[model samples]
Target: MALYEFRCRECGSTFEVDRPMQRSSDPADCPDGHSDTVKLLSTVGLGGRARTATRPVRPPSPFSGGGPPPMGGGGGGCCGGGGCG
Candidate 1:
């Protein structure tokens, strides 16, 4: 499921809904109880990263000091590269 943002023309209300991609262009009743609403052309937040087709690009690993420790193994350093208590 993906989240879509819709702007109601009748009530000038902007809202988000979780639905399939097929329903993104389908007629949706306004949350304000209006039926004359139409989806507006708009830009979503976070640069539309949520809807981007590519896999999310993660930040560089802070564990460059070495490869990550063995999975499920106990480590004592902060993953963020700062000293751990």
Candidate 2:
């Protein structure tokens, strides 16, 4: 969908219209049924909603044994890399 802004010459009122890009040549009328309208150039719209296709990969945390904790919490052990437990 595409957004377009227009001003009515007959009523001096501004309005917006949504239409497909392929049907751009279609005429727009004012709310009071006036075909005498002017298409206004808008600068604020950023088009339709978009989203990223890929998610970011997060590395394992140190508390899970990926690496040593930043502030040091757990003691080294057999289950956690210490030999005697």
- The numbered model that scores best in TM-score is 2
Most accurate candidate by lDDT: 2
Least accurate 10 contiguous residues by lDDT in model 2: 69-78
Rate residue 40 of model 1 by lDDT: 57
Q: Between which residue pairs do clashes occur in model 1?
A: none
- What is the per-residue lDDT of model 2 for residues 1-85, given as tens digits with 9 covering 90 to 100? 9888889999899998999978766779998899999888776676666657987978766456565534545433335553452
| Per-residue accuracy of model 1 over 1-80 as CA lDDT, tens digit each | 76776778777998877888777787777887877766656565347355556778665454554556545664435553
Q: Please list the Cα RMSD from the true structure of every candidate, rounded to 1 decimal place.
A: 12.5, 7.2
TM-score of 1: 0.44
Model 1 has an lDDT value of: 0.66
Ten consecutive residues with minimal summed lDDT in candidate 1?
Answer: 74-83
Clashing pairs in 2: 77-82
Error of 2 at 77 (Å): 50
Model 1 off-target regions past 4 Å?
A: 42-85
